[model samples]
Target chain A: MENKSIEQLNDICSQVRRDCLRMVHGVQSGHPGAALGLTEYFVALFFKEMTHNNQFQMDGKGEDLFFLSNGHVSALWYAVLARSGYFGVEELGTFRKINTRLQGHPATEEGLPGIRIASGSLGQGLSVALGAAQVKKLNGDDKLVYAVMGDGEQQEGQVWEAAMYAAHYKIDNVIAAIDYNGQQIDGPTEKVMDLKNLKAKWEAFGWEVIDIKKGNDMEAVLAGLAQAKGLTGKGKPVLILLYTEMGYGVDFMVGTHKWHGIAPSDAELANALGQLKETLGDY
Target chain B: MEKTLDLKFTYTEKKDTRSGFGDGLLEAGRQNPNVVGLCADLIGSLKMGAFQKEFPERFFQVGIAEANMIGLAAGMTIGGKIPFTGTFANFSTGRVYDQIRQSVAYSGKNVKICASHAGLTLGEDGATHQILEDVGMMKMLPHMTVINPCDYNQTKAATLALVNHEGPAYLRFGRPSWPIFTPKDQEFVIGKAWKMIEGTDVTIFATGHLVWEAVVAEAMLREEGISAEVINIHTIKPLDEEAILASVAKTGCAVSAEEHQINGGLGDSIAQTLIRNNPAPLEYVGVMDSFGESGTPTQLLEKYGLNAENIVKAAKKAIARKMSY
Candidate 1:
């Protein structure tokens, strides 16, 4: 797809929100809160930001690669991957179904078109992205590697291990984003486990940090991603601290961690669909 | 009478199996440009120095982070680079099992997890570093190929052979210098057991450091006129059932030996095979559900009953049980 205008990207974002709600509601088992909040970021990435091929190849040679570290938001990833022409958009109906490639977490086991690694166990994707980025450097491929993780996932020690490694090695060909929604399964990240000074933490670990103040806004996300892209290949990995609401599109779902993993009831689904416009038509 | 292969063997040198891995890795890097090496601050311990020196661009020194090293190795496989991650067996498996399960095995990334200093043979580092359950842990994961080669020659050959195996694999070797009896130019085929001696009384299935011990047991049994079949079961996961069953069909009883715990090591795999296919009398020679301690490799092996004397005793007991049955 061509570089979509901000209006087109926002339209895709709304459709993705609709897809995330319905997919979670259809299965009665999926993470909708983070998925809904991350819709705009995914839209900006697949539609307007990444230099990628919709015709997916596992190796992803000569093209940008994205790894979903916080794979609970797989509903958002699947929606955008389908809209960007990776596979049939109708396959969204098979989310979490038996024998479907759309697993509860993003996995490469079933040969999911856009997925290169299995992630859900948390705090592993950053290391993987750095590895892919290192491979890109080795192959003389100028393309970049991208990854997104949950703010709550920063508690994992392996994440810091990877953080230290990326900086210590001066791996500069990757851009990583954290879905800084400040909410997790139980409650707010602060009450659960405070991620104090996250930007300072990344900066301390030697990453160039960029904070998108309005991550839910499509234009802000696109510009933030572009800025992150420009910061790459300059001797340090770049991180975009995307500040999105946990459940941005729906009013009732917003401002609470209750929808983090639970599927919506019929009434709640209807409410969510009402808030998200049927812009590109629902899958 | 079962046809017995020549038992006479000779070795001119003794070397640590980790060196075999290092040499084979350098050769592999030379042969395939796609081969890359990643170490978790164990360059000298894992003998990955030559590879790092020759291919500095491809060698990744990922500090002391084994978890990130495993993930990085898995990620490197995306662009068709075959990554060989070097670390101690304990850190290689138990310390980062979730990473291996999710990023490497379940995701089906072609990664060579080259683990050295496995089992009680790690010696003096005590129980914390010596991991006896790595084979069991790795083999239980679906799509994982587990290989525990016996000596320097076999370990080196296994390292080179893994470059073409095309999937996730755990290459388990040890630190102590061992008898290099296996052919210097031997072809290492995964899952194919090498029958060193064929006999009718009993079969001894051995792997890693215990393979040489089983060879010595064969010689001891020869003096007692108790003909024994000694098979080096290098590849433990794809358990070489054909060779196992065929040998046991002739011998009627079996003995399993390894430098690991008896509960989940080679003995368990052999016993499972026997009970399912050909029920036979079997005995185990391994660490008996206990932790290792600070000691020399010889003391540790002897204390753990992972020696020729133990194999001989286990073999005789297995034969006696077969007669009683």
Candidate 2:
């Protein structure tokens, strides 16, 4: 975290956003809103802040552990895996297909690189991530675990249970991120179930709450990640409430829940693709 | 992951089926460093108090939250730890069915769902605690393997066997202490049925607490000149079809019994087996479509028509049915 520069991480974040957009367009299905918004935090962890081996095996013994709780944004995850050299970027086309190793959701069924659990059902990932982190601590691994949860997903009661458990255990080896995009499938999260004072809630649960403005701003996100890493193992769990715009890059998909589960038709995909440059080759 | 057991068991003492599960949990946790256990505040009832004491770090007391406990276990499976969840039979399957289906079954994670206090043998807890529909609910899941062990030694053996097997499994047992028949060293295979007695008139297939009941019925039928064959159908989902077919083909009549509702238990498993492989006249002896009341295990068995006499009556009735055919 100390050695990596913000500019390098910001460039990687741009590539990650491009990858997220192209993969969603290629599959014609996926959630782009939160994926684009949380690009910096994930990019910061993998590309700059965290220590991990890109060529992943089934077990992550000494390496850093990460769980994608909100698995609907699997297009972003698959692209990150490919770019991070866990697998080939060429396989991104096979995403959401019948025989593809990349299913519509994240899976470990095919030993897909970088995926430990299959998570399509929301509210289960946080607990699973905590369990993995607990295992790492038991095995005396000093490496950290990072998990991302959607702001809307916070409405689930299990999330609070996990939050209480982590803080009570002083699970400093783990860090959780919330994609506060202000929108879910139904509408704005405020209208659905207000998460007002959400960061304060985490604080009350004995967590060191960190706030990040402009989730897509790679530099600020990288700095926030560094601060988070510095706070590790301090006898408290840390939460980063990342402020982001839904469907960040694609103009038409932005500021709405319309693209949450809807796949782009040929026409919609072409329109979305027009906004994003092919930084990495298309699948 | 399947460790071949070297301990040769020669059962000299009777043990309850719930204690068998408790024994296997302690042994499995000792053997595998990755094995962890969870209970929804049923440490004393499920006889998991010993396991909890031995490995406090590996054990989780998830309060009374069965739904949250299931979700935690589902999440724990992701990080490559084998999570065994425990609760009452009714709460484990029905109360948190969606959690099991979406989290464990559909996700295809390796989880051992150990359910106790099953069937009418749950006694004074009445219909509330006794879960007769668990076997049916568990078998309905595509990836789930349902097992109902006969006695204490067999339950311990089945729990050990599930540690090596991958995928979601439902292991059910009762609260009361029943007959601990069968050899102690018998290997509990998932889908293999053990032939307890040989006969020529009718095949009696039984599971759970009723296995001992069926064995008793066999001895009683012998005095009446009816040679009733008995088969212990332990693993209900991956049912031992080979033995069932061979036994019923020779006997020409079958009677299935269990401490459960007649609609979806060992009776249904046996009937389906005979229907496809060997069409035989079958009569079932179990709770005849009603909820159980507060009574002793023996009294409940008699009240619900699950006793040895009912099985004997069903066997004689099946013989009459076979004669008509």
Which candidate number would show the highest lDDT if scored against the true structure?
Answer: 1
Which residue pairs in candidate 1 have backbone atoms (N, alpha carbon, C) closer than 3 angstroms, thus clashing? none
lDDT of 1: 0.92
Q: What is the interface RMSD of each candidate, in Å?
A: 0.5, 2.5
How far off is residue B28 in model 1, in Å?
A: 0.6
The sequence of per-residue lDDT tens digits that candidate 1 reaches over residues A1-283 is 3667888878888899898889989999999999888888888878866789978899999898999999999999999899888999999999999999999999988998999999999999999999999999888898989899999999999999999999988989989999999999989999999999999999999999999989999888877887897898899989999999998989998868999989889998887888889988777
For model 2, what is the error of residue B75's alpha carbon versus the real structure, in angstroms, after optimal superposition?
4.7
Worst 10-residue lDDT window, candidate 2 chain B: B1-10
Candidate 2's residue-wise lDDT over A1-283, tens digit each?
Answer: 3365776666566667667766676667777777776776777777777777777854577878888888887887887778788998888878787889998888776678888777777777777777778777777778888889898999987788788877866788888999988999899899999989998899999999998887878777877887888888899998999888877777887778877777666786678767766654554
TM-score of 1: 0.98
- Give the clash count for model 1: 0
- Give candidate 1 regions above 4 Å deviation: B1-7
Residue B97 of candidate 2: its Cα lDDT?
Answer: 84
Judge candidate 2 against the unseen true structure and give its global Cα lDDT, from 0 to 1. 0.82
Q: Write the per-residue lDDT of candidate 2 for residues B216-242, one digit (tens) a residue.
A: 788788777889898888999888888
